[model samples]
Target: MITTIISQTANVRDVQVETIGDRTTIFRSRTWDRLKFEIEYAQQKGTTANSYLIQSDKVALIDPPGESFTKIFLEKLQQHFNLASLDYVIVGHINANRMATLSKILEIAPHIQVIASKPAIKSLKEVFGQYTSQFHTPNHDLDLGQGHRLQFISIPTPRWPDGLATYDNATSILYTDKFFGTHVCSDTLWDEDWKKLDHDRRYYFNCLHSNQTKQVETILEKFSTFKSKYYAPNHGPVIRYSLSRLIYDYRQWCQAQQTKTFSVALFYASAYGSTTILTNAIAQGLEAQGVHPLLINCELATPEEITQVMENVDGFLIGSPTLAGHAPVQIQTALGIILNTATKNKLAGVFGSYGWSGEALDLIEGKLRDANYRFGCNTFRVCFSPKEEDLVKAQQLGSDFAQNLQKSKKNRPLTLPTNNINNLSSDRTEKALNHIIGSLCVVSFKQGEMDKAILTKNISQASFIPPGIMIALTQEQKTELLPEIGTSFVVNILKEGRNLRRYFSPSSINTINSFNELETKRATNDCLIFDQALAYLECTVEQITELGNKWLIYAMVNHGELLANTGITAII
Candidate 1:
């Protein structure tokens, strides 16, 4: 009889590939909701949990999902197959609660046998109860009558306490619990094409791309010897009959990481903006010669952020200004946190300004060296007011640091293409805009109106102005607004009173109502107004371009909202 395979979720699939007389089954389990931690990636929008089943003579179930999904999984398995007796349960990784759940299965099938690696058996006993007789090594194969058998292969994953890969010799299939899988979600089990495969592989490497590269490469090399037809990983889908492509990609990823030599983190604290200027100059100099620098502001750098940057950064540059013979408190706190948590193999440099005693740079440099950080170059110090010579020296220091980075480096930077926004909708546009605004805090607008009195009152009451309102004022109002240019200000509307009356004009009011109606139609159809507005260019009406037309066509290019500025001589 031909065994059937059922795909339940995007990543999870039930495989019933049989060999000889006895039938075996596999189910790929989804461990994570989305592939990566955050939801920025496009492909990981709707990923599911994965698990696998093996129905040899002795029915074996591999790694199961977390506690949240186990009850449903058990019910589904019982509905399809006989559960009176289970012969073996294989523990791929010695995760405590996952394998310990075997006891729950034993409640129904008390005669079940459990198998794992030598170290895994110890871990199981340590975390769960001591069930010695049932626990055995993968060196022994479980026989599934009539020439079908299941074998265990130990692939040491140092990152995990005890990790092993299970092999089904009958179907030439391998069960890699966490290895050889990417954080990609797809309804299709096999990534038959290069595009999907490449995307998943890159995601896998970039996420787990640190110290496990070598271990992953070793596992791939060992598994390449087998004539494998499918790979049912714990997290993602099964690979149907194509192992060479994944192995090739894994090798390339590992080799690339081995060649990455040096990296730097540039942290600056700017109160009067001089530090920002210096930091940008240094970053530009580093980038000109192919050096990667993780630029961060000392005031904004949190412990978690600093720890992440320290993982791969090979050098550090701390920039601050003197505050009463000491570095700024924020900069000092950030540097202190980094120094305490930082690992070895990183260098440090310090630069700052002082009015009196030159103490801030020296103090920062001393703290860094006390933490055993290597010195990149002599600490580049500047006086109370930096001159042309001081700036030039700072630039040279950056160039020299870049040279040092090149000397220690072996790999090229990973290149990812920019995402296209042509087909994006208004809701998604708003979300992206909100994210950008939150991060950069820069707002600009061409035309909008708010009373100057309201603006001034709000600013006086509250420390900061809210975003997205342009105050219309006259030339005489310039003096009142000059102080708030970088903060908030009012701009003069030249044709003021006339422009105000034009907004209420009968013709202008009719045009505005029509535009609002068009907007409503676009929203109902789920079509973008930007596209509809752009379509108007092809209307082909000669009279629309007449110079004496009273209507002014104004496009809010950034927001894609349309407005018309009217005058008798205005062209449509």
Candidate 2:
């Protein structure tokens, strides 16, 4: 049978094939260009789409990448393996982003059995229709000749309900599709430099898994039964050297989420997806205020789920899209459940979007009011698609709800200790750390006789006892000009540095007496201080830790002072 070539190309860099283990080959599609569409790729470190193949008598390919890498990935894959001999395509998780790749795979090799959990099969059928007739829902371990036995674990989370994990009994290699993965691309395959990948891994987990704490924790427990030597994830490097460390980190991260001081159970039903967008904006705001929302789509949720989440959470936010001038029946049902089963004293908020009418918001708010539930913010109504400012307002409304909860007696603060920070335990601490807006400053640097100044906004308070601050520098930075241990420098916090930023950015640092370009003076530490700075800190470098391609400089604040009375610092 002649196979038609069909795949989507992306802004990709290259695709490489390598054999990792016995009968296991990996096709890594790498892109040096950062993804702009997804919030998860905000770091701009670029990414890799990792697809693994295991062959014995039977062959299996696991977790094909999205359309971004689909074209080149398939080409590279065909050059390595005989598609006609392929027996199974094990889908760990299925999403629209990967539909193109899976479709082309089936089109080329029609006899291939697609193995996944029930939900994943459903999703595949929904996307490919009758073509998914070859899909298999694994109920038992599949054995290939020569001891290549595969056990499938259904590790479903709210975000990815079809999340699955595959374990090879013979090789002791576990394939965790999205779990324990980072977005950074590298020349090396194994996590030999896991210390450097810490931030990226934590960032990935925060963006994807933080909100799915209960499910993640339970999955961790389920995975504890398996004895795996190596973890082959869907992104970045494979976990061999840092396998135990990452699993422990996941456990700590999950514990932190469960220990959060406040929780928001968000119930939303959207028609035409307009209300969903508004809900996302609101959730973003809540996250900004350090309150993560447990999102539940009312249409997909069950009555028991509604009761469990509503009864236990510190607060609840309800949103709906008006259908025939009334709330969706699911929304109505959820509202009824909350009104009857939920306590009136619980913090409550409501929002809705409508093209014809917004009576749904009014109905939710009225019912909630009659039930005597305390309102966190006024009901937010949208006529149709929300504007930029409207989204901002929605965010502010979410912030208001979280801020109000902070004042309530039911909520308590969980401060993440700065010192001896080995692992995560306090959820607020992680959230608070991420949310702490740093004041942009032009920091002084010294190497030998050369003096330099560079504008940066990555400064964060690291310790309270010594009043220390941490600054991150890219690994490609001019190390000869960097502040080494015992090197003293001045942090000139910007007052109104928008226009003045040109003096210190794009081409900042390296110039001898760069401060001469601006009005400056010497601090007590003998470092140059900008005259226009809002505040100045004289710091001495104490510790330098390497994180992947970045150098994190931790320094003690020897002396500091506020020069201006104005509290305003950010200049965008």
Candidate 3:
């Protein structure tokens, strides 16, 4: 993957160009030195804003990188071809952040047509204001000459309503903007080091797609008509070799998120992206407890959508940012919807950020309290933007709220299906399955400052080449560390220790940190390796699939050592 440098300056941007296909070149405006404001951008993985240039009898540039790369991106573009040669400047989505870059493009290529989805066109008009007439909304496929016909698909998600994807019929390449994208930057043109990229890709998926699974699934189905050889996404490595595998992975991941039993409707209105950061942290906390979080940016979410989510969820969380000492109009509208549609028995939570007075937080807190809603935790409020400590606190509060909800439902009757079927065969199958036992193990993991462990009897080898193993456990409130794909953990194979299982079993009080009482050593992955265990395998979660109330986590073994060679493996 040799990069052809077109232009570079000391303090300015460095534009690297790589030709991926016959007539397609990727102009990647990489911001390796500076970090963006978004939560995903701060990941420190080195981000790239990929812009593709297609040359045929006509020319088109798809998706100019955001405002940060405005000057240098245009400078690099000037080095290769005349601005007049660029026929179309196609945008996958529209937002205020990219206005500067788009404005620069319009200035340089005044005669060039701008192509986008109908919804995106509206945003373009709003952003461009007086220059709205320069835009062209696409209702049908456009031919760019030399047998290169372009097709646009309007695949909108709640967070990004103006979302669109482009396909080049000539090269059979799908330019999936934001779909199947990670924030990591590298010189590798394809996903050849997929094993190393698993963590970053899964993290990106969880941040964006966890709440948008339904829309993502629909888009996947809609894209099935196209025979795409490569998925040239907006960021990360282009999918040249692992296209089919990535698509299947996305489907499985989204299905698992959507199929969770307990769900939370998280409504928030972010000002300057602060509230969104807090929202993501809290969502991560809920997901760690096996509670599916339905994130809704109130600014984009409709009243009907809010009502539907509140009705289906077991609990709800509301967060907002204060502007002019009041909650945003969108937050107010969401509050009204919640008051009307939500029941008194459902658990509720409130959190927000404010620059000056926290009147908005008090307003939301009072409204929920007056409506006889039970508070899952204390109302959390932070000043201005949340710091690292604040985000961590928010996450911990969310985790505590989820655990409280589960505790309240401890003695509640299991809601079984009403459809009458073969009861005898089901009972026989259950008994037969339980009779087959395996080695009892304690799975422990550490992410950031938090450490957690779980007791499990279901463990088996999933692969031999990678030396992998699969561990399956039921979703529980006390379980703070759900084995998400890309996380690292250690499997401590117990040595005929029945008491160890009891210690790790579910209790009224969470004792996940009970390992402090035992002799443990930290593995290279930073997971607590039990000293008394028969053996331990340091592994990274490779994939996660859901089965009923349990999550089947598959991990690739990275390191292992035998602690007690003569000890027999503990059986369930």
Candidate 4:
């Protein structure tokens, strides 16, 4: 299933496209929530880009997003089909300015060619070298074998390098380069709420307004004659059902150069200068990274500040200091209000400081996780005083948070690997193995066999033997060691003959004899014996080896199995 995991509050949908035959698959990005956008400065929860996997006779991918998105894209592709078999990756205009990270794609499918316009090729080379090769984009038809052909038309756009639109002849789908598109908080790819579209279009226009007119005109002119069944823009939804209407609207809007302005609110809290330090640092970072982080302090910041910031800001950040064990009551209350009141398009993050235990960070993280807030890492405590190391960590946190926020501004999903059992540690491996064995035992025992009999039989029948009979300590060595409850009897057996053991107690001899007999019987059953008394099992040989003149034998069970489960059962 092509599942869409969106940012908590973002409206920018990410498309995860899978196809059977000429089918277009789209995966939407996850949404971001209040705490993410307002406080943490890393408000955007997940910043994975979107790519459309078009499966015709020749598979084509459109505008593979960022590194994270590409990872997910390739993984999903591998899950469905062989990545090495993929034919072409068409670089759409929308992702021209963004770093495509083609290295990742090449890693999966080295032979696959990345098709883009001349300018896009330059940008791709400049941004990602050695991963992609140059491909021509002419106002001509390029045929992919089996009648699946695409017409590439390049139009220089203000925001991107030589934005190009592709027309799939088979599907009559017009891959728009940002010509007939709008910025809207939409779940559905095509034909969103006009009002929301207007708001987002305004945002896009204001951001792209400087050179948008020329780009829009060029795009409209290039495809003026072509009859399109579907309008797939790089940013927004693909206008499948109503192509002409959306195009007409976009044309009129572009001609008018209409711009809309909105506001954003940034709320934050700080102590010992960590959060406060990072808050400003993040804002500066965002500005540096092409996102505007509105800085606000909840102690003095107003609702109007929040509203104003929210109006224009696509993302927000929240920062705080852990008070007692949770976020400050004021920040929590503000978050509650934002959650109840804010419209979609807002992304948030949680940041804070603590003294020792990360209780507050955990609480905030819980809140974010529970509320489905798409957020970055938690702001955590530094021991007592604010040190240079703490500040540096805080700055790094701010930078990462801002990057995620910037990513959300584009409405990308965060694509991360799903951890499997192979990544577990030795202890966890042991536990898992034991569980599997236990489950097998349970299943086996259900067939009318007693648990004790089965377990004991299995244990006794293993080939590995214990240390008791294998090691023979000298008289001087035995005298130097402290004797435990069972050791004295075993020692006596080592010094005296198996039949002549009256030097110790009669009970001790009987115990040793019983142990020996049981071990022998177990060894005979399966050629393996489990000696539970050994500190470490050796597998060098069946006979004991003398280390430092002390005879030491390899601990083995009769059936060649190692004894890992020790000290759990009685020999009798």
| Candidate 4 TM-score to native | 0.40
Which of candidates 3 and 4 reaches a greater lDDT? 3
C-alpha root-mean-square deviation, each candidate: 25.1, 25.7, 24.7, 24.8
- Candidate 3's residue-wise lDDT over 198-310, tens digit each? 78888888877787788899999978889999898888888887788788889999989989978887899877667777888888788879888888878777667887787
Cα lDDT tens digits for candidate 2, 1-572: 11222222444467767777788888878876675434467688788888888989999998888887788888878877777788899988876668788988988888889998897798788777867678889989999768899999999865666788999988889998889889887667788889999999998887677766778889888788999888999889988998889989999987777676778987998766667667766776676677867878887777678877865687899999988767776786577556545654469999978998787788678766644579898899888878667777887898899999878844454533322221332222221222112356778765555667777887866764545788888765537435468888887767553355666673345464444667777777766777777667888889999988889989887776656533335433
Question: What C-alpha lDDT does candidate 2 achieve relative to the native structure?
Answer: 0.75
C-alpha lDDT score of every prediction, in listed order: 0.51, 0.75, 0.75, 0.46
What TM-score against the true fold does each predicted structure earn?
Answer: 0.45, 0.63, 0.66, 0.40
Error at 231, model 4, angstroms: 1.1
Model 1: residue 125 alpha-carbon error in angstroms: 0.7
- Provide the global lDDT of candidate 4 against the true structure: 0.46
Relative to the unseen true structure, what is the C-alpha lDDT of residue 48 in candidate 1, on a scale of 0 to 100?
Answer: 36
Highest TM-score, which number?
A: 3
Return the TM-score for candidate 2, rounded to 2 decimals. Answer: 0.63
List ranges where model 1 is wrong by over 4 Å.
Answer: 1-22, 28-43, 96-100, 263-345, 348-371, 374-572
Q: Number of clashing pairs, model 3?
A: 0
Clash totals in order: 12, 2, 0, 85
lDDT string for model 1 (1-572, tens) is 22444443434433332232125543433323443222123355434345556675567777765554556566666766776766777778755347545656767776667788787787666644645666777777777665557766677642343677877777777887777666655445565764656766676554333334556777787787777777877655567745777777778877765565555777777655566556655654554454555566656455567656665576778888877766775675456445534543456777766667767787777656644566766787666656556666766787788786566444544422212211221222222212110011111111123212111101100101121322222333322322232323211111212222222222111223322322222222122122222111100011111124221111111222212211110111
Candidate 1 TM-score versus the reference: 0.45
Output the lDDT of residue 180, model 4.
50
Query: Lowest summed lDDT over 10 consecutive residues: which window, candidate 4?
Result: 437-446
- What does the lDDT come to for candidate 3? 0.75
